[model samples]
Target: MLCENCGKNEAAIHLTQIQNNEMTTRHLCEVCAEGMGLSSGSSASAPLADFIAQMGKGMLAETVSQPGTCPACGLSLADFKKTGRLGCPRCWSVFDASLRGLLRKLHGGTQHSGKVYLPPHPSESDRTARIVSLRRSLTRAVESEDFERAAGLRDQIRRLEAGQEA
Candidate 1:
């Protein structure tokens, strides 16, 4: 998948974060990941396993920065590891850094490599893609001082938004 952050390079880093029963996921290319303070010594050609290991180390550092307690339920990392269960839903995040390794070992990988759902049209996401494309083109046009082209793109964006609202 493409990096959602820059929409340029292929995503080299993928993260899935769960907190308060909500899951947030994002994919990032190396460039963007480094910018976000997720710097790694791995190169683009580094093995996936290596990247994951590095990411796990990073996560471990973050969680252990303050304390071992879950902010919500006060479940300590040691306790969670001992019990092999979480005290509450919030424990997932509280122990996220520590669990990446266990999950990698248990599942053989942190990411799923399987079939996925794909809509026949994917209209909404498709529209969003179009808007992003148009916006990029609009930026280029404006940068090049092509007033006519920029105006056309601006109009197209407005029409797309109108359709979306309706």
Candidate 2:
């Protein structure tokens, strides 16, 4: 088929999207696919369908079943597809040839270039700790009938809640 987007080259890439029980498909050549960020080295992250398209476009049909099953859990490609899961951790290594190649194509290269995840920031926790300490002091002031200190602590907590540095 001729490329749908550019109508210039032969289509080598095909994409399909299903939304709200409706299906839409696009056929594109290498140039158009890359322009749509559906190709390797694209800065924009492709969605799950793009990942599947990268896998199933032509490779799935041409791939010969690698000989033998996973040594650790005995999972074949067919079993993995049918079950939609790997048999065990070792399945990754056992299926390394196929999996790694697919990953390389879907991502730009073998190394992960995307952002590494980080936990909540330390300053946020520190703010929470400060708030807790102030609340405790406020409670102690109230217990001792120290209205002036209690009011000051209450105002500090209100400022903290308002996102002001107290």
Candidate 3:
């Protein structure tokens, strides 16, 4: 498409503005748009951005002013923010508003109500630690020549490692 401004260059951007009950559309190439001072249109409203940032900060501060207690687990929102995790399901309900705001900011104004996937069994870190501890016990049994204890420890370690792969 030819640029509305130049007519010679291909249109690479579309700028839309509404004023006085009339909508105006500007089709322009990047160079023409930049020359017309329309490339950084939003940055022209820096004061508005600053005002919004201040308002958001104030809202977050107000939300955190009073200690929030989860109705289900009695966990505090302030504590959860500090720890980066909620104590229980009730904490989610108690801090629903604040969490919604946070989620919107993080995910582009959309609430996250999606499915969560969990590991089938213990995580690799847990499996590795358990296996290490079991191996130590197995070594002790071997040193004492207790075949039965060694066999049991070996079986436990196998189960833990197998769970990790699942």
Best by TM-score: 2
lDDT of 1 by residue, 1-166 (tens): 9999999999988878899999999999989999998855543334554544444444443454535688888887656544455678987766665676667665777788978987767777777788889999999999999999999998888878777531
Ranking by TM-score: 2, 1, 3
**Where is the poorest 10-residue window by lDDT in model 2?**
40-49
Q: Runs in model 2 with CA error above 4 Å?
A: 1-58, 61-65, 105-109, 118-125, 158-166
TM-score of each: 0.30, 0.49, 0.29
Where in model 1 is the C-alpha error above 4 Å?
1-66, 114-166
Question: What tens-digit string does per-residue lDDT give for candidate 2 at 108-129?
Answer: 6877889988968988878888
Model 1, residue 41: distance off in Å is 48
- Any runs in candidate 3 off by more than 4 Å, and if so which? 1-59, 62-67, 112-166
Candidate 3 residue 164 Cα shift, in angstroms, is: 44
Residue lDDT tens for model 3, 1-166: 9989889889887988999999999889877988987764443445544544443453456474445587677777655554445677766667777766665765667555777998756666677877898899999999999999899888888877777432
lDDT of each: 0.73, 0.77, 0.71
What lDDT score goes with residue 151 in model 1?
Answer: 96
Candidates ranked by lDDT, best first? 2, 1, 3
What's the CA error at residue 157 for candidate 1, in Å?
A: 57
